[model samples]
Target: MKKVILLSMVTLAMISCNKETQAVEKVKTAYIDTSKLLEENNEAKDIEEKYKVKSEEMGRELRAEASRFQNEAASFQQNAMAKGQAWAQAKGAELQKREQELGMKQQAMLQTLQQESGKEMDSLVKRIKDYVKDYGKKNGYDYIYGTGDAATVLYAKEAYDITTTISKELNDKYKGSEKKEEAPKEEAKK
Candidate 1:
């Protein structure tokens, strides 16, 4: 009977301890400030702008290339038609085939360059993720969240928003660093 009583006490203690552990576990909520993150990682914005510019340039280049190729192809068409009468028709077919092979190589190179830009974008995204994780941990955030197109942050408990605190720290540190760097310049002007 005493052993049974002792076993019950031990079971109760274990249950209480588990309850205590659950109670102590920190409740975490997190949200992403995409604008803030984009601002923080200026590289992302730069990449986007540069991507737009390069894409426009590529478009222009392709347009010009297409025109040039069209003119050449037209010339070949005439030559082939004439050569068909002047020589073996098989030779004209061979020339047109060669042009197609060259066109494919050009297309492949453009695709590769486009893929390279995507890689740069992916790298920037990874850096932003690292920054957010660091910011969350440093600021005692138990949970972090991502803000998407339809913001679900409509009404979060005020306590969940550690963003202002994190933002202030980031801004203040940046300003401080800038001030330090500019101090010597101002002193020189004086």
Candidate 2:
């Protein structure tokens, strides 16, 4: 009887340990190809398009200013020969000043466009990260790694990639919000 009781207790302890081991939950992990996500996302595409249009507009403005400056310089050159030396010297200085001003304006416009584009891109990245965090939490993911230019994940199975899934969800959310925004405008018109 003592031998049987002792054996039973040991068996019970082993079973308990086995049960605890079996109860351990697996860690759910996924990876996103951040470059793919950005490339595929509609909002990101729109932002790129917006910046492209703005850059083109700014480029046209700069070209127009440059054309005006060239015309003015040409006019000064024609009149410089007929005008006295002193007048020519002063006009030359004025033209030089205008050229410098145009260069500065071009630099300023480029910097402004770059700054604006950077800000928008940064904001979009933040939104994507927040969305991923929320998605991971909702979907019971323990970790979501990113693989891109500066890849955090060097190697992951294709099955573990959540980039396409996240992109689709993000684009859907963006489309829904766009509809909501348009609805408000439509109502305002009425």
Candidate 3:
């Protein structure tokens, strides 16, 4: 009787463990390309495009100022050399201070834009996470991972890539939004 009871318990335990392992194997694992997602994400893309256009305009204005300064620099250099070494030393230090101030201002503006862009990127990441939630629910993914930053995942199996599918779906969704926005404008123009 003791031998039979022991055999029964071991059999039950083995059966339960086997079922648990099979359940685990049925789960789908997925890896996401986060860089591609952020780059092609609609909200992030829009912010990036706006930043590019604005920054280009700012750069042109800065370049024009640079040309003006370069022309004036020749005069400053000539005048300073004619004066004593002390005068040149003082002028050079003043010019350097002004340049440093301008550099700091540029740095501030860049930091502001970056902060704004990063916020938008954060929003996009949230959207992707929400999408992944819905996707996991619908398609039965066990684990979906973002592999862009701070990830230990070096390489995932080829079957585990969810980038292209997500990109296509998100791109289509963005196009749908564009159509909705443009519809009223077209009607007004017509």
Candidate 4:
């Protein structure tokens, strides 16, 4: 009879502890629109502008090079009739080699630009992800979902949407960095 009573008490204690644990367990969830964050991110805009300028510069260089090649070809064609067949053939071969080289150079330039842009974008994503992870950890969020047109999160309460909060935080951080960057320049101008 004592053994039965002890077993009942132990069971009751275990159930109470479980109930307390359940009461303490809270799942905090939030969601952010990743596309909106990227759009509002000043650093991303600056990077985009830098790449755009670079691409335009590259395009101009390529166009100039192509124009030079076309001029050379026109001159070669004009001189070929008077220069004789062998000389013309040799010149044609040289022009072909030059054209091939130009093609390869253009390809290389495009690939390099693509690589640089990709690296910058990847770095930006990593930075954002790190920031988000830290934000989640600091804010005690159990899960922070990302939603956009792609919509990783299909439905969530408006109160649980933290996109504006995070976007403001990131923008403020970016603005602070920009101010810090300008401070040195301002001091130098002094």
The local distance difference test score of each candidate is: 0.69, 0.92, 0.81, 0.92
- lDDT for model 4, please: 0.92
TM-score-superior candidate, 1 or 4: 4
Clash list (residue pairs), candidate 3: none
Q: Where is model 3 more than 4 Å wrong at Cα?
A: 1-6, 26-28, 39-43, 81-97, 152-156
Top TM-score model: 2
Range of the 10 consecutive residues with the lowest summed lDDT in candidate 1: 34-43
Question: Of 2 and 4, which scores higher on TM-score?
Answer: 2
Model 4 pairs whose backbones collide: none
Writing each residue's lDDT as its tens digit, candidate 1 over 1-190 gives 9999999999999999999888677666767665565565445566778877877776786677667766866776767666766554565565667668668856875787679788997886676567678887877877687554546565666566555555555556556866898999999999
Predicted structure 3, TM vs. truth: 0.76
**What C-alpha root-mean-square deviation, in Å, does candidate 3 show against the real structure?**
3.3
Query: Model 2, range 87-119, lDDT digits (tens) per residue?
Result: 999989998998999999989988998899899
1 against 3, candidate with superior lDDT: 3
TM-score of each: 0.55, 0.84, 0.76, 0.79
Model 2 lDDT, full chain set: 0.92
Error of 1 at 25 (Å): 9.4
Off by over 4 Å in 1: 1-28, 33-41, 58-61, 77-95, 147-190
